[model samples]
Structure formats: C-alpha cells, structure tokens
Target: MRKIAIAVSLSIFIAFLIATAFLIHPFGYPPSEMDDYIIENTQSETGANNAVTAVVFDYRGFDTLGEATILFTAVTGVVMLFRAKKKREK
Candidate 1:
C-alpha cells in the first residue's frame, strides 16, 4: 500500500513537471523598452560586440556574484547531506 501510494505520487509529480516545462514560457515575455535602451547604450559606450555578454559579465557582475553564492550554497548542502558519520570506538 505504501509503495503504491509513493509510486502514484511520484508519477503525478513527474507529469506535472513535464506539463509545466512545456506549457510555460522559459525566457518569459519580451524585454521592456528600458532594457533595449540599456543594451544599445552598452554596445555604443563600451564598444562590446556581444551586448548581452558584456552586460552580464561586466556591467552587472554583482548579479553573477549572487549566482555564484547560490551555487556554492547548493554544493555545500549536498556535501553535508551525503557526508559520512564518524564512528565512536570504545
């Protein structure tokens, strides 16, 4: 009974995940006017070929810092969860 319930729940969760992935917009709506202005200005001001890359890696480096921090936290959590317990000897 427990196994059957778990299997049903997992199947439902997987189906929901697939439905959401296909139904939802991944990149979301089009960028706003201000976003376009920034891209244009960044290209002209900085003379960078790829405006988006320049903005992400140079103009908005702080956001990248936050993303790195989140990645580090996730890795730490996984390590802690899988770490072996120390044995106590008499």
Candidate 2:
C-alpha cells in the first residue's frame, strides 16, 4: 500500500512537470518588459546615470540593507567571540 501511494504521487508529480514544461515560453525568448522598463526609465525615474547602480542601491535598497546588516552582525559576532577567547587566555 505504501509503495503504491508513493508511485501514484510520483506519477502525478511527473505529469505536472511535463504539463508545465509545455506551458512555459520557448527557450531563447525571455520576458523583457521589466528589463526594458528599467533601462528606459532608469535616468528619468531615479536620475541615476548607471543602471547597475540604480538597480542595486535604488530598486533593491532594502534587500541590500538587510544583507549588509546580516554581514555586519556576523562579523561583530565573530570578533566578539575571538576577543573573549583571547582575553580568557591572558
């Protein structure tokens, strides 16, 4: 019974994957609306001359900030741990 259930689940998942593969857009043709919009409006929207800078610091500002915060926290934790161990050894 358990084997039959697992087989049925796998077959259903395989059918779903095949169906999805057919429904997706063909290879080499990407959806370009977002990229087009960004390129066209980067200067006007953010007045930034660099598109890469605009995307990183403007469009993804909060995400970048969160990453920076996590990185800073990790470094601080490591430094604190090392400093404490050094002090204990002395």
Q: What are the per-model numbers of colliding residue pairs?
A: 0, 0
Q: If scored against the real structure, what TM-score would every candidate get?
A: 0.49, 0.64
The pairs that clash in candidate 1 are none
Would you list the C-alpha lDDT of every candidate in the order shown? Answer: 0.82, 0.95
RMSD of each: 5.9, 4.8
lDDT of 1 by residue, 1-90 (tens): 999999999999999999988877666785478778876788677788888888788888999999999999999988776664323221
Best by TM-score: 2
Clashes of 1: 0
For candidate 2, give the lDDT of residue 83: 98
Model 2 ranges with Cα > 4 A deviation: 1-28
What tens-digit string does per-residue lDDT give for candidate 2 at 1-90? 999999999999999999999989987797999988999999999999999999999988998999999999999999999999999998
